[model samples]
Target: MTWITEFAPTTEGLNACIDCGLCLPTCPTYRLTGDESASPRGRIAAMRAVDRGLMPVDDRFAGVMDLCLQCLACETACPSLVPFGKLMEGARAEIAAHRPDTATIGKRVLFGRLVGFRPALVFLSWLLAIAQRLRLTDVLPSSAAKAAALRPVPIPVPSTAGHEWLPEGEQVGTVAFLSGCVMDQWYSDVHVAVIEVLRTAGYRVVAPPNQTCCGAMAAHEGAAYDAARMAERNVAAFAGHDLVFVDSAGCSAHMKDYDQWTEGGSDLAVRVVDATEFIAGLIAKGALPAAVETTEPIAIQDPCHLRHAQGIIEEPRAILRAAGLEPVEIDPTGMCCGAAGAYQLSHPDISDELGRMKASQIVATGLPRVASANPGCEMQLKTFLDDGVEVVHPVEVYWKAINTRPVRQAWRALKTVPRRN
Candidate 1:
């Protein structure tokens, strides 16, 4: 079989790479392997080879493509402004169409079928939480154990569908929130904080019930048809809202490109805003109060989706500062933590190497806590970082800073913390 006629990547994006090698240092896979085939240019070269009918879309070709984290840092570094992310996604789509392997089939099942249903996802999360609590994951196979270990412990209850929170004071218009599938089930606390923070800033927040997964995981896995269907569903769900706020960086990034996936999605795409960006704007406008009391320093680990994909570098820091926290820069280069959606599960070895690199950088800063926006990054950091090191969403830290009483904070500080493992 050859490249899927309809799903093949556009030659324009494939030919945009000029072999400048600027993307090499920024690519996680290339940096780890020092292999030209792993570099962005090398991958594009392979894509071109296949596009020209010089190579076959076989296991070897799929292996090279699968190795990428899809972090899109190379896009930021490329002088030619190559759309590496889109091109890579297209290549993967072609592979998925022509290959149809067991793993590909499983990815389609999980991302396409399972993620869209909140009840099933929550039920599975509950079971996984129980398994983690019981330490049953340790007894599972190596790969299964690793996947289970990433599940959030003490999983918060899923956010209510179609829930709406009114502003604390004067009304300042309404906005919709994306309670993502995995995020709503596992990290619902962050959504609570997001709502509280938004309300505190005088914006009514609503979690649209009709919204489903942002389809980022599906898109990254080459399930374009499923991804497009999910995008179309979200476009219809979020229509009429002037602004749709998303707390998950990965979701925010994907939603911003809805036009690429489906018709009528561009309107929704333009309305999507990263929560940090919106909150930062509020802070700049003095919509929220200044810090009541200063907190400890936090190292900011920028998710690749947030940093490279969305080009939101300083907004998170702005939010952190308004909460009276000093945000430390672990790496200005914005190296990926290797949690590019499901990349950690698919490429655990490379993911671990990158996670360890990020953890070491954070540890070197000697900060007690790390502030990360994306759920995947937070989990990856928690897995590799020292058990004592607290990993939290920046908004969670901000919420605690403004809401927690001094006595309660002191009491909480004195309580013994349990080991995550």
Candidate 2:
């Protein structure tokens, strides 16, 4: 029977699944639950059933879709190259459109509207900062509370103005940097580190003032229309630049597929590169110095988006090695830390379980520091791990080791420089 639903999972995508169950072993949920339904293969079967009208897009279907972390671990594991992530997102889009309960509507508004909207996001950051200072975050839901605990001090709106970093020597090229929604307000220091790394590579970095979020959170949750709108806005924001560098793994992964969301998205999507990839490229070209004797052993926690979605397995390690630091590889294949873009809030038990497991693995290495690419993964590592263990973006570690002065001092010195238009 032909599928009549407007946003039905693509038949070709569903057909690509060979059902070999290769994804079963890699799936975090399946590993946790030992249930087929939690596996990617099982989820694909459910999508097929819905497409054939054999199953309704009811609460069960919603549960199946929502329970997924969308880490794309299955996509990496699938030998058939089945676009399981896209199919699951398609099914979720249908569910979101047809079923509009109060909870669903509230989440749709929150993720779709407020989260990516810069002004709203900044305002919420301020509110969260206040909540955190007052110790009122305990009243918040689990995931939010955890996020608040990990959040760096909020930078006010005035300080949110964009900056352009001019390369000191002969410029390699010009690129636009995406200072992401929550990232800018909460983790501003990381953005600073990203700019410093770019500067060190001799690349002029322009951070457009009016940029919005990359909309990965929206797309993952099936808010297709909002995600598309966000993609269009970002494409327009960084239109003139040849390269657009994103430091956030989730944001970079989502922006790389911006073409799928909007009409002119390819213009931006094609230019998008992950910060680690860009820095690694610089190191390979000898544009940046190598290996500055870090005495401590560092552990690299591969963010799922970087490792699975973007296929960036080696660049970070290469960067670590270049910085004169030894990277400890975690066991069990660097599985998801359950910070899959708010998955911790939605499925606290599984999220916490995965997080604890990851923390255990990191601790086993006996490393004082853990390096990760994504802000969420870093936050999760920080929240779940031992207090003595410090979690940071890999670039931050590299930046600290490479720069002569302290990172904070270098960041402050950079901030004093005016944006070079």
- Clashing residue pairs in candidate 1 are none
Candidate 2 per-residue lDDT over residues 121-234, each given as its tens digit: 777778777777787875767676685546656545423337788986568778788988877778877888878887766788888887888888888877778888888888
Scored by lDDT, the top model is: 1
Which residue pairs does candidate 2 place in steric collision? 291-322
Task: Assess every candidate by TM-score.
Answer: 0.92, 0.92
What is the alpha-carbon lDDT of model 2 when measured against the actual structure? Answer: 0.82
lDDT of each model, Cα atoms only? 0.85, 0.82
